[model samples]
Target: MKVLVLGSGAGGGCPQWNCNCAMCAAARNGSRLIRARTQSSIAVSPDGQRWVLLNASPDIGQQLRLQPALQPQHGLRDTPIKAVVLMDAQVDHATGLLSLREGPPIELYVTPCVFEDLTTGLPILSVLEHYCGVRWHMLPVAGEQRVAEFVIDGFETLRFRAIAIPGKAPPYSPHRHDPKVGDNIALEITDRRSGKRLCYAPGLAAVGPSEFEWMQGADCLLVDGTFWTDDEMITAGLGSKRAADMGHLPQCSSDGRPGMMDALDGTRAGRKLLIHINNSNPILDDDGPERAELAHRGIEVAHDGMEISL
Candidate 1:
């Protein structure tokens, strides 16, 4: 399995245009400790030739421009990415599909719940139908597929399953607060030839038994690192919601409560990394205590253009 961190920042990306937050300030000043980043997204390939994006961010155009291997080739209009697999219907995750509308028809793997949200509330899909058409592959919950397993084209070397996770859908969706089985998911992708597993859940609220089981012994575990503390934004004067309220499990402990680090004690993943980092998170500062703690624990912070192979 070949993995590439296409963009490592959360929704607005590091150094958001309208903010002058500490980290954003540093990023804008070209501080090495606070490198700029785009919205969160990743690409994976069983073989280097054909790639599939885990999620398409609004920065898709710039993200692709930065990675040569993902650029178009072979024809006048072409792209190395063959498809996109969405984890949820959040604005940051699904809006990038518009940037891809100029090329060939898009092939997507998504839950019917998310598909409906895009078709109605967001209308991204309904709009795309008039552009380069979309091929929707129903990404079923594990064990729900007719063949006992779902497969996407160009990904035969891998076995992947979407595990229903307890999370809120985007505010634009009718099921935003109601929560449904397919509103959100975490993916477990395994490379058949190498027996390596990758468990990805960038938008996480709380840890569940099933989520821990999926992370157990994974070769690469890329989980959420959106906020440093549950009240990060509140304290930073950025927002009023706690991390959990926004569907992200903060990395830091507060009020003597265990954090994501404590929750991951037994997983023992070969390599544990953090993804979808928010610009407000102090962990982005390489010299900060938060970052040092993660390093001491052997956990890496994903960065744009970072590559990992297993």
Candidate 2:
């Protein structure tokens, strides 16, 4: 199984336009330690030829351009992307579906809640229906008897299940309701033939008992690292919302309490990486103490174009 990190930054990306925060400023200045990133997204392939995008970021076009494997080669419109699995309905994650309108019909996997949210709130499904044929499949939430199975061109056996994580609906949703099952989720993909597994949770709010149990012993675990500290945005004077308030639990809490890092420190995953990083997070500065701390703890901060083979 191969996983590709297409983009690693949060919503607006590392050097967000119109923001002059220190990290963004350093990135704008071309600081070698600071790397610019697009919004969070990844592509996974059971075999190199057939790929499935985890989330389609707003910068999907640029992301695809950076990866030659996904480029057309056989024919004028041939593409390696066979399907897209959405983790949520946020703009950064779902807007890129528009860019895929010109491609051949693609399958979209999402939970029923996410499907409804997109239909009523963003109307992405409705709009895409006009552009191209989209085969929709409902992703089975955690604990469901059935799992979503797919047959990639070159894979022997593969299946995926969605594990519900604690998170609320997107802030912009017309229906501002409390967190519910399917509002946010993590994906666990298992290659039955190879006995390798990967868990991806780029929008995790809190890691509960069930969530941790689901991630145990995975070959690769790519998790949320949206903020370094809970109050990162406020401390950076960028926004009033704390990391948790924005549906992401920080790596470390503001009061020095244990956070995601503390919780995931000794997990048995073969490799652990942080994704969906916010621009204000100090970890973006490669030389910063925060980055060193994460390294010491055996956690990697994912970057664009990173590839993992398991």
Candidate 3:
């Protein structure tokens, strides 16, 4: 199994436009010690020929251009992407669906809530209605959804289990008035051909009991690292909420509490990585103290262009 963990930054990406933070500034100045990134996403392949995107990021075009395998060779019809596995309905994660509009109508697997969001407000289907070869498959949180020979098992995120801060909810739904909803999922995909497993959760809120079963067994686990310390934005005065308040449990939390790092380090999974990073996170500095701590825990921070074979 060949897996490509694409863009690894949070919603605004590392060097967020119009931000003058040290990290962003250093990145813009081409400092090797600092790095720039796009919104988070990943791609996997059973044979390295038929690729499946994990999420359609805002940076899809540049991401595809960086990967020769995904580039179309025979005009448009020869695109390699076979499907898209959506993790949530956030703009950064779903907006790039348009990048593939000219190619085949790719299979999209998402939960009911996400389906509603996509259909009612964004209407991704409508945007690609004229694009032949598109397909939409409704996937659920607790059941199996199959695509080709791959068996995809989904687990719900802590969107409902965790509280959403006032005025910090997704800009798309201000009232938060959906009938029955929450940010839909995280996924554990297994290739029947290779018998290898991958667990992907970019916008993770927290690691709950229900998700442990898959996390403990998967060969590779890509989890959220949106904030190195829970109060990152708070301390920086860039935002008024803690990482947890934003629906993402920080890499480490406040109240002197240990966070997701502990959960992942204690897990039995062989390969573990942290993704969906915030620009403010000190861990983004490869040689920073926090990065040393993650390394000491045997955790790998996901980086753009990083590849793993299972």
Best by TM-score: 1
The segments of candidate 2 whose C-alpha lies over 4 angstroms from its true place after superposition are 142-156, 254-257
Candidate 3's error at 147, in angstroms?
A: 15
In terms of lDDT, the poorest run of 10 residues in model 3 is 157-166
lDDT of 2 by residue, 137-202 (tens): 887663442234444344456677777788768866654465557777788888877889999999
lDDT of each residue in 115-174, candidate 1, tens digit only? 989999999988998999899998765334311246778789998878887678899899
Ranking of all candidate structures by their TM-score, best first = 1, 2, 3
Which pairs of residues collide in model 2? none
For residue 136, give model 1's deviation from the true position in Å.
Answer: 0.5
Best by lDDT: 1
Root-mean-square deviation of candidate 3: 5.4
Q: Note the Cα lDDT for every prediction shown.
A: 0.87, 0.85, 0.72
C-alpha TM-score for every candidate = 0.96, 0.94, 0.86
Per candidate, the number of residue pairs that clash is 0, 0, 2
Model 3 residue 60 CA deviation (Å) reads 0.2
Give Cα distance to truth, residue 94, candidate 2, Å: 0.8
Go through the candidates in order and give the C-alpha RMSD of each one to the true structure. 2.0, 2.1, 5.4
lDDT of 3 by residue, 8-112 (tens): 998889899978777787788866376778889999877777777888998999999999888876664688787787877778888899888877667887656
